[model samples]
Target: MSARIQEPRSGGEPRRGETLIQQRNRKIILCAALDEFSAHGFHGASIANIARAAGLSKANLLYYFSRKEELYRALLTSLIDTWGVPLTSLDPDGDPREELLSYVRRKLQQTRTMPRESRLLANEILQGGPHLEGETLESLRRIVQSKTDLIRSWSAAGRIPHVDAPHLLISIWALTQNYADYDSQIRRLLGEEADISDTPQTFLETLYGSLLAS
Candidate 1:
């Protein structure tokens, strides 16, 4: 009796026997690709390096993703999904102070937890937002507009002081993510003792109180 060879699945259909090893390999490739893209940017990262980092041959890496661009897109999409959670939580029905404070805390937590992803996004923006064109840009714009509307409503209802809603959102993002994106400068200026996470609550409390106080 001869053993039968199994074929891998594609296009939303499963093969007869997709092993756990294949699933694990896919995850490893993704993790390695993220680190590589984050460190080198899309133009600088190489498939061979990613393959070596992923502990797979270039051919095997290609088996999961057809090309380098495909892998980079997958990583960017994953980052965007994770990065958008806090933004999506800005609530119109919630108390303004609590809602904004929660947003600040969540942004700070993401900064500490996913600094690499922040850096990757910064790199993408610095490179002229090449990968984030068309529908990607439109989707992001829509989300920003929705949040800005909520901010405007908060101001109109006297829940918060008057401020440019879009600019306010920009400012909040800048202040919170600056520590992570500019960690080198921050570390140099403030020394190792400076902890961003410890200061967000206090800083936000003071800032928000001053800005929103009647």
Candidate 2:
């Protein structure tokens, strides 16, 4: 079963069966919320600020999202669903090495493309994920458990070297997410105007390739 979050549109697309204006406003609000939430975490972010950022009145924003917590959680749910897309595609029947490598590549792509979303999630987690408590947390755990079990099976079958499945997954997340979460640090070291390279993709694939070799 896919572990993707199946919540109705909240912070993302307009809810089903809404007028076009409502759909447009929801999209605008979500984009603005992403900016605010990324800049300031949940506690520091406010409905007023998000409303101003969205070019809507506080009442208008509230009409779409009744509460700040509601808006924040909706945004988070949408992000997790987006991130889960690549993860859900990790095929147990595929060659273990290739499957894992492809996962690494896709994660790196997300790191580069969805830096704000990545940082937003990082902030939530660093703060103990106060918003991601109920079903969201359960689904995340279920997905991680499923992937780890698959990794363990690969190890048992001699498809890959004996490895700590959970830590291996954690390492992949840390390696990929650092590129976005600490991008300022990376820029400071590499120089602001310097041309970025595809070293992350090359280095990660090569590293995991060796680590997963049977």
Candidate 3:
């Protein structure tokens, strides 16, 4: 069996200054872990690599995260937290088309700017999302379900076409995330002959605008 990893020594309680430092350290470790995990994936990534990327010793890195699974879970949790907002912010009080388009824009923006993080999460899921299956997955399901409920309500009110809510959300996720997850293939097919940065955004907007138009 693999040896168990050690938790931080600072224990459950920390002083005000210590808490601040802990937060800062955890933030750095998380960022470094993002890069490492994104580049090398979970099994290929290591404490030494993360610590080096974060400019800390392996022991110091462990001070923030108890083990590799702990660190990986933190990274996935951060991705969920960062991307959860667009879904949660879908206002029932707002126009359905605008709300969904706004959500599409936010998701596409993450693909454009934070592609590594996007792929990292996608990779985890492709491998069955073991670490992402617990509370993190539960929280995501709740958010998606709540928004899907709003979409259903809108459809019932004759605001949007009566489409399958969960399937619609899945389609939106696939369309937006494909750019990040398949970026290499996409860029290769397009070659250097095209400027593609803003095209995806416009294309997505138009596509959803037509699909969700009442």
Give a tens-digit lDDT track for model 1, residues 1-214.
1111111122112224768887667777776776787778989999999899888999998987888887777667666656777988988788887888788889888888777778778889889988875554567678888999988988898888897998888888888878778998987888977776787668876896678675
Looking at model 2, residue 21 earns an lDDT score of 94
The segments of candidate 3 whose C-alpha lies over 4 angstroms from its true place after superposition are 1-23
Worst 10 residues of 3 by lDDT: 1-10
Comparison by lDDT, 2 against 3, better one: 2
lDDT of 3 by residue, 93-166 (tens): 99898999999998887677778788888888887877776766788788888888899999999999888999
Local accuracy of candidate 2 as per-residue lDDT tens digits, 1-214: 1122234244555677899999778777877888888779899898898899788999999998888888888889878767776777899899999998999998888888888889899999999987876776678788989999999999998989999999998899999989989888888999996444497888888999999887
Global lDDT of each candidate? 0.76, 0.83, 0.78
Candidates sorted on lDDT, descending: 2, 3, 1
lDDT of 3: 0.78
Q: Return the TM-score for each candidate structure.
A: 0.86, 0.91, 0.86
lDDT of candidate 2 at residue 167, scale 0 to 100: 96
Model 2 weakest lDDT span, ten residues long: 1-10
Worst 10 residues of 1 by lDDT: 1-10
Clashing pairs in 2: none
- Pairwise TM-score winner, candidates 2 and 3: 2
Superposition error at 141 for model 2 (Å): 1.5
